[model samples]
Target: MIRHQRQNYDWGINAEGSSLEGGAAQVAMNGDTVFIHYICRDEDGNMVDDSAESEDHPVSFEVGAGEITGNPLFQAFDEAIRGLPLGSTTVLEARGGDWNRELFFEVPRDHAEIQRLEGRYKNQGGLQDGLIVELSNGGSAMVVAVTDDVVKIDANNMLAGKRRIFEVTLLNIEPAQR
Candidate 1:
């Protein structure tokens, strides 16, 4: 079962760019697919990610599917969206742990992805310390240090160990197909 808290949205006000607001609609339930756009920030109010700027906008996920087990963000989102009205903009909160084996890990400097980043910025004085490089896998990592033989990279989710605030707009919801 999913556990969560709730602070429902105000009535009659539309979520940004949402055309479904104020219309009769069913609430999202488990086994339903939800379309959403969200902006997440940490305790310090630093923007973590804005789905609007992502290549894949209006992302969809199934509530309670837990396809990626042990992901707290996913769990929190499942908690937030379940039973939420369509076309509502809700604030979802979660406290992240400092460590997650799947998210926090290091890779060799010579790793293909790192090398690719190095190649991209080669003419620009090469890779530098503290440069956050975008990975081909759609993830990002910070360059801890670059040494003669090895580079240190920290690919931890930025939300780890911090209070998270997700302003999630529920654009639409539909029954999960299959």
Candidate 2:
């Protein structure tokens, strides 16, 4: 398990003579791609997700690039890690109710579209056209119903609609690939 520790540093002027405030010591800047490992838990203290289970689990995303914008938990994570230096570990809290309702509402509709496409596939077996799949962003979804021109899919994440706490560590930071 990764342990969390707090460190203090002097905020000195940068090479451009700009004053560094807050915890900006060797921090990630806009457009910087950061690699992080995180463990997330709900308010009840149940582990929802974690990247520290394996060395290969660290995830990378560009700061301020909207990669994690859709999820409120991730948005809080983005905010907490912004001014933190590399190799720093911090705990962040997020209220799931803070997520944009409209955005969450759209996910089901989008999943329905995916379900429709799955139903249209010719390789469906003798059973009804129902399949569960994992999304690229680590969510699981399943086709629950299908009709002539419509399909219903249920996609949900464990942390959705729950207050969450995240223990995150910034492992590395580099320039954005593009």
Each model's C-alpha lDDT?
0.70, 0.58
The alpha-carbon lDDT assigned to residue 62 of candidate 2 equals 76
- Per-residue lDDT over 1-178 for candidate 2, one digit per residue giving the tens place of the 0 to 100 score: 3333343212210110122345536787678888999887778899988887776777877787644467544555565566667877777665434333332322333465455445454375511335665555566555556555555545644334656666788889886655
Per-candidate TM-score against the hidden true structure = 0.57, 0.49
Give candidate 1's error at residue 18 in angstroms: 16
The pairs that clash in candidate 1 are 97-161
Residue-level lDDT of model 1, residues 102-163, one tens digit each, is: 65445677788768888987887777788777878888877778887677767775545567
Where does model 1 exceed 4 Å of error? 1-25, 99-142, 147-157, 176-178
